[model samples]
Target: MDFYLTALVQGLCYGSLALGIYISMKIFNIPDITTDGSYTLGGAVTAVMLTNNQPTYLILPVVIGVGAVAGALTGLIHTKLKVNALLAGILVMTALYSLNLTIMGRSNLPLSNLPSLFTLVDISTDTNLNTFWIVLAFIAIVTLFIGYLLKTDFGIAMRATGNSESMIRALGVNTDKMKIIGLALANALTALSGYLITQWQGFADISMGIGVVISGLGSVIIAETLIRSLSITSVWLNLLLVLGGAIVFQMVLAFTLSTGVNPLYLKAVTSTFVLLIVGLPRLFRREV
Candidate 1:
């Protein structure tokens, strides 16, 4: 039970990453690999700040800002320099590895002894329970904020910029600028996931974000599968499904581990699981 609970918390942590991926891949149709770097950037920033006795509230905005900058750089490279989207993301992600190392001054930073956002409130006697509620509340707030943002006039313009760039551009929308801002917003959310996970895991490692984008992609794909199967079109419901997908993805992994799968083979297992999620749906659809 405790193991599954921990996985639930982790799922919530990665919920932010799923949201970020949804914005980048689903909305903008850009497979931004910057997720790998910006995620660790958030953890790096959070770990450094917490070790230095920084307030949690103060550290969050800084994390978001730094993540946005990393994402915006990718967008700039893609839009202004005429780089392919994939290559631009790869360039920025490569650069962020060194930047993260420089920021941390080492390979890992421990935060076990430090006060964190999870410790700010005591909701239950069990530490895991408290962390669960804190994470849930934070995710809920973020989902609501994003859902509201997507319904506004500016948000509609941003969506338009992604759906039909030329049409939106002809209508006086700055498509390039929108792309930049969209990527920035996407990475900012991804960074927030890093912020939460670092504290939850009690340490931040330079390698923690490696291949992290796969989890996010898997979650988004899961959500997309459900959305298509159900023909759901409401933005709020879609956001909730994304969060649900993140949780389900993590839960599946937790179940796999519980079944005595070798830890060494976890990555391979994850890949296969994601492949099944992606391929099974298409196969069934084709058969039907």
Candidate 2:
């Protein structure tokens, strides 16, 4: 019971990044690999600031702004320089690695004894239980903000830019600007995940975000499956499901470990599961 509960908590932390991935890969139709770097950048920034005794509340906006700047830089490179979006993300991600290293000034930074965002919360007697409630509250606020954003006129225009770029452009929308804004928002959310996870887990490591995109992709795919099966048209519900999918994804991993699978093969398990999630849905649609 504790194991599954722990995974659910872990999922919610990573779900922030998952939401970002959904925006870039699903809505904007861009494979923004900037996720890997920007995630670590958030952690790196937070870890350093906290080490210097920065205020906990201000970390939220500062980390989000930093992540947004990273995303915007990638957007400029792709839209202004006409580079492939994927490559632009890759370029920024590569540069960010060195930058993050410099920021932390070391490979790993530990915050085991430091004050944390979760330090003030006393929601539950058990540490894990308290962490769960804190993370839940954080996610709820973020989910609502994103849901509301998607229903706005600007958000609708952003969606159309991806769905029917020609049509949106014909309507005099600056599609490139929309893409930039979309990517910026996407990465800001990713950074928020970093901020929470770093504080929750009590440390930040350089490699924490490596290959983390798979988890995000899996969550998005599962949410998409739910959207199709339920015929959901409401933007808010769809976003909520995406967050739920992240929790489910983590539970699946927990189940795998419970069955005694080697920890070394966890990534392999995740990849296979994601493949089926993505391919099986299309296969069923085609057969019907």
Candidate number with greatest lDDT: 1
CA deviation > 4 Å runs, candidate 1? none
Index of the highest-TM-score prediction: 1
lDDT of each: 0.96, 0.92
Clash totals for all models, in order? 0, 0
Measure candidate 2: CA RMSD.
1.2
Report the C-alpha lDDT of model 2 over 1-288, residue by residue, as the tens digit. Answer: 888988999999988999999999989999999999999999999999999999889888999999999999999999999999999999999999999899999999999789887877798899889889999999999988998899999999989998999999999999999999999999999989989889988888999889888899999999998898889988888888899999999999999999999999998999999999989888988999
Q: How far is 192's C-alpha from truth in model 2 (Å)?
A: 0.8
The reply for model 2, stretches above 4 Å from the true place, is 286-288
User: What are the models' TM-scores?
Assistant: 0.99, 0.97
lDDT of 1 by residue, 1-288 (tens): 999999999999999999999999999999999999999999999999999999999999999999999999999999999999999999999999999999999999998789999999999999999999999999999999999999999889988888999999999999899999999999999999999999999999999999899999999999999899899989999999999999999999999999999988888888898899999988998999
Worst 10 residues of 1 by lDDT: 263-272
